[model samples]
Target: MSTFFSDWYYLSIRSIKQIWRPLLALIPSLFIPIFFFVVNSSSLDAFSKVPGFPPSITYRDFIAPTALFTAVFFSSGNAGIELVQDISNGYFKKLLIMPISRLTIILGRLTEVAVQAVMQGTIVVVLLLLVGVRIQTGVLGLLAIFAMLMIFAMAWSCVSMISALRTQNARLVQSLFVVVFPFLYLTTSQAPMPLLPPTFRLIASYNPVTYIIEGVRALVLTGWGNPAIWQGFLVATTLFVIMVTLTLGSFKKALR
Candidate 1:
């Protein structure tokens, strides 16, 4: 058990060091969400006062989760790109021959992603607080919010890892954001579900990002009483399990 944890720790540290530059590159990922939050809140501030809108919650509070989610979604792709680089440069091949468990290698990379997610989420939360967004659930809710972001990041990273392992192509892995961006808009990012156009509301209902955004919003705007919080957690966990299984399968195939 000690050996397993030791390997996991070392590999995670090494991956963090190797990917520091790419992590630095993700600064823009963090900024874009903040910028979106600012512009979106500024434009929609008055909408918060609408009769159906949740009482006392500003547009900033309502949209803060989306901004955090955007940062997490974009940042999660970096691990896969880094993995693809390792494959292209023959580093992955060397690791395959080592006595280390294959799962640890992937977990190590994912740990780095989780760390990045926490940092990115923290920055977003801090910025949101600075701009007058307060969490109704208080500090505990803030912690839960961060935990959800990390889980979301890990799940999304697994998807990217699956792509990297299967294609060994950095370009393909990088293009994932293009695929993810549409989901962002299709969900309840910009406004409440009822406020959305009928067509958009229908689509957002089926979108997992909708649940995630709603869940996080519950923590910020409502509290644990909101059913959306548990639903979002379930969706995120389902995504994590499915993607991690696929990623492990892809990693196994790469070994063959």
Candidate 2:
């Protein structure tokens, strides 16, 4: 047990360092979300006053989660890219042959994602605040947002890592990630659910990201007692379990 944890600790440290070592690679994850936030918030500033939109919240406040999440989701892909790089450079196989337990490698990479999520969330939060966004749920709500995204990032990264493990193609893995990002806009991102077109609303209903974003929107604009608040955490937790199971299964196959 001690060995397992110690191995996780060391491996996690290594994985965490690899992410920070590339400044250029990390810049887009940091800037793109802020750019998204600034553009969307400004262009749609008038929409917050539109009927059926949530009251007492600007478009900037309503969309903060999407921006924060953009940072987290995009950065999570780096884990898979790094894993593929390790495989290509022969480092991954070396780790596989080491005395450390194999599962630690995945867990270590997840730790790095979790750390990156928290860091990215913090930066985005600070930037949002600088531009006058406030969380209705206050400090506690902000902390919960961080915790949720950190878990979500770890869970989401598993898919990317699995993709890398299967194709060993960084471009394919990244391309798929980019393709799926538009799904975020399909949700209640630009306007409240009531203001959305019926067809789009129906689509958003089945989208788990809708619930996650609503949960975050609740934290930002409505505070607790909003039933939708717990929905995001539930979805994130469920995804974490499913994705981790698949990742472990995939990891086993990669060994053979």
Cα RMSD (Å) per model? Answer: 1.7, 1.5
* Candidate 1, RMSD to the unseen true structure: 1.7
lDDT by residue (3-116, candidate 2, tens digit) is 999999999999989876866888888898899899999998999888887777778888888898788877788888888888889898899888987778899999999988
* Candidate 2 local distance difference test against the native: 0.84
TM-score of each: 0.93, 0.94
Clashes of each: 0, 0
Mark the 10 consecutive residues where model 1 has the least summed lDDT.
18-27
Tens digits of per-residue lDDT for model 1, 135-249: 8899998888877777878888888888888888899988887888788899988888888889999999999888888888889888899999899889988988887878878
For model 1, state the Cα shift of residue 55 in Å: 3.8
TM-score for candidate 2, residues paired by index: 0.94
